[model samples]
Target: MKKITLLSLLAAFVISCADKSQAPGAAPVPLLPVATVTNENTITDSEYPASIQGKVDVEIRPQVSGNLDRVLVDEGAYVSKGQTLFKINERPFREQLNNALASLHGAEAALINAQLEVDKLTPLVQNKVVSDYQLKLAKSSYRIAASNIEQSKAMVASAKINLGYTNVTAPVSGYIGRLPKKQGSLVSASDMEPLTTLSDVHEVVAYFSLSETDFINFKSHYAGKTIGDKINHLPPVSLILADNNAYPQKGKIDMVDGQFDKTTGAITLRATFPNANGTLRSGNTGKIRLGINHDNAILVPQSATVEMQDKIFVFTLNKENKVSKMPITVIGKSGVNYLISEGVKSGDQIVLSGIDKLQEGQLIQPEKSAPKVAQIINKK
Candidate 1:
């Protein structure tokens, strides 16, 4: 009787423990943060490769051909307008001027001799001591001498002008480029390469290209009947330097190409930026960031999305608190959030954290608080 009671008690204890272990709700659902999708207005940036150029880029070339006597400015030097940039050998030009002056003197002396002969012949012809033809010939000679003096004077003036060309001066105030021709090197007005280049960097222009489709989309986003009107209403843009840093100043779109390139089908556009500090230079490269605004756009945090086979998906919560993996159509990205066009709507809840561990049809206990979509959109 004692063994039977002990065995029955032990079996009862074992059954009690098994029943407790198999009770319903023994395992708790995972508690994950969830957020409701909302419609918000936001702006996204589009970057395009751009090439920088100064507002005034001019190639400095000689106006006359001669040996370079002196290079007044060094490479990368800043110069002012009317500053002498180079000096050519002036000996040849000086000699030419002297020759012209000597010719003028000779013509004047001839005029004096002709005038004397005409005076003597006119008196003799009046007295009938010689024929009138002698006086006429002497007058003609005097007239020819006077004409020669005028021609010689013109030659002297031209020589003076040519002499002035020997001193090359800057046409504008800017920084100088390379000095390809050294002292004593022969340079000409028709040389294929310029002596140097001057760039006015107080203002800079960035040139970038856009494809045909991009151009059409760009025009449709603005509220204007013409491109010029659209540009007037457009907001200022930013420049990203080669080092991936944003430029301190903002720029405005000022020009657009009239036609697209037939081979590349891309249209070029220009944006001007102020560089009062001389931070930017010609031949520098960067990217132009253009902002586009979207209204009533659906936004989702990137943390809640996952990529699989080149497609993005988010875990959405149903009425029963069950999570379903749904694909979203992402139009663009603003800051840490993506602008969604489809797959989720307002009032829809999505898993905000630990999305990697989530599986389809999984039950989750959503937290009461949600992320601020407006704050995220404005972070851009």
Candidate 2:
């Protein structure tokens, strides 16, 4: 009887413990995934690839005809106005000038002899020793000699100008390119061959085109906002070359095309940048950026949204702490983010991660996750 009572007491204790373990409403509710909401209105900037260019470029050519005796400046050399760039062989030009001078001297001597003959004949004709026809002939001879002297003087002047042309000088201040014709090569004035190229790069101009649609949209959106004025005060422009890592200087818009292009349906634009350091070269390819306006929209991290069957969706946390799957519309995609246009508000808590095991209407505990900080790259 004692053994049966002990066994019954032990059995009752085990049953009591099992019943306590299965008590009502004691299971812990699991937490669901979550994320904070953000408004797309705050991010209203964009960037594009632009090019660097110069406002002025010129080609240098020789004006005189001769053998290129010497080149005064090397390729890629900075030069000033009236700077001598080349020296043509002046021997031939000097010889022509000397011949003209000799001709003038001979004509002057002839004129002196003819004048003396005319004076002697005039006295003879007045004294009735020579005929009137003889005096007239002497006078005509004197006039012809004088005309010859004048013609020779004019020829000398022409020769001197041609000789001066042998020394070629720069017409403007700028950097020069390589010589097209090497030294000892013959060049002509009629051909006017390009000897080198010079460009004024101190203030460079950038050339680019914009679509007609974008141009019209900008004009309509921003009234009284002239294209030139819109980009004028923003910031100095920058250039990114094909190989260069960064732009060397800041620049600004200098000109916008007065007329739109009819063929391409685009408008041409230009921006000027300071190249005091000579870092920017003409004919270089690079990128340009211009800022427009700000707008209100929706933005969300790519991870928070899941794509199923070509449809985008996000798991959102409701006020009841219940997980709900919401369908969303994406307006634009930039980098690793999506700009949402519908289905989410600024203050809603959306799930960023840990959504693979969640089910609809499942009772659970909610755990708050820390908001993710984003690095904003300003596009101006």
> What does candidate 2's lDDT look like per residue over 46-119, in tens digits?
33455555556887777778999999898899999899989999999999999999999999999999999998
In model 2, what lDDT does residue 181 have? 85
Task: Assess the local accuracy of residue 107 in candidate 1 as a C-alpha lDDT between 0 and 100.
Answer: 96
Name the weakest run of 10 consecutive residues (lDDT summed) in model 2. Answer: 371-380
The alpha-carbon deviation from the true structure for residue 237 of candidate 1, after best TM-score superposition, in angstroms, is 0.8
Clashes of each: 0, 9
lDDT of 1 by residue, 245-349 (tens): 999999999998999999999999999999999999999999999988888888888877999999999999999999999999998887678889989999888
Model 2 bad stretches (over 4 Å): 1-51, 99-158, 189-193, 221-235, 295-317, 321-380
Best by lDDT: 1
lDDT of 1 at 364: 96
Q: List the residue pairs that clash in candidate 1.
A: none
